[model samples]
Target: MNGTSDVPDRPRRQCPGCMRTLVVDEQNFHKDSLCADGFTRRCSDCRNEAERIRYSLEAPQRARAKRERRAERRAYFESIGRYEAA
Candidate 1:
């Protein structure tokens, strides 16, 4: 008789961030993350953040707008002699 038959079957997966063992069908398997439907495994947090950033309006454009607003404010302050150089 072969002893290999006694071994139970275990799902195989690897974490995207750490490349660690990620058991399939487990709670940590596909909770949240951008993972390929095929064989790729990605951490939940990483995936969620990516999705959030992608869908959020606070992207690089927002940052640029903020910078422009600040520049406008600084120019106003300078014109009023309220700007102090440190």
Candidate 2:
């Protein structure tokens, strides 16, 4: 993932779960994690853990975020209304 030639290369690591060797380059800004397929993917175990956590929190978290964004937009529009009237 390190497109820049200056970086030497990513060090390879063996995945404990899959038993596959994969190269992970910390210098690459684009990839969060590298899999054995040389594709960007979270480790299997980590992905499963994240999914479990996400399922538990997704509903309320999403609702609160949406509500906050809507409130922000309403406030911004209200603030601009007086200027537009003049």
Candidate 3:
């Protein structure tokens, strides 16, 4: 023996989000963020979809937050008598 372990390789995994059979390899899986496993649970396509949906749902809130921040900055400048009316 060349000193390699005799354990069999793991079988392919099914993506929980898409139900697609996938080979968990460097080319397919991403580094897991939750630290439960070494690879991500969902496939790339599923991950992208999830991100897209999340952004779409939160877009309005994000835009509103940005506008509020800008308004607050303008108010602060005005209070300091440095803001010019436009």
Best by TM-score: 3
The TM-score between candidate 3 and the true structure equals: 0.73
| Candidate with the larger lDDT of 2 and 3 | 3
Which regions of candidate 3 are displaced past 4 Å?
1-11
Candidate 2: clashing pairs of residues:
none
Task: Give one digit per residue, the lDDT tens place, for model 3 in 1-86.
Answer: 89888997765789898899888875667778575667888888888888999999999999999999999999999999999998
Number of backbone clashes in candidate 2 = 0
Cα lDDT of candidate 3 equals: 0.85
Error of 2 at 6 (Å): 40
Write down the TM-score of every candidate. Answer: 0.36, 0.38, 0.73
lDDT of 2 by residue, 1-86 (tens): 66668767766655554656666543321244354545444445555666788888798988899999988987888888833424
Clashes of 1: 1
**Higher-ranked by lDDT: 1 or 3:** 3
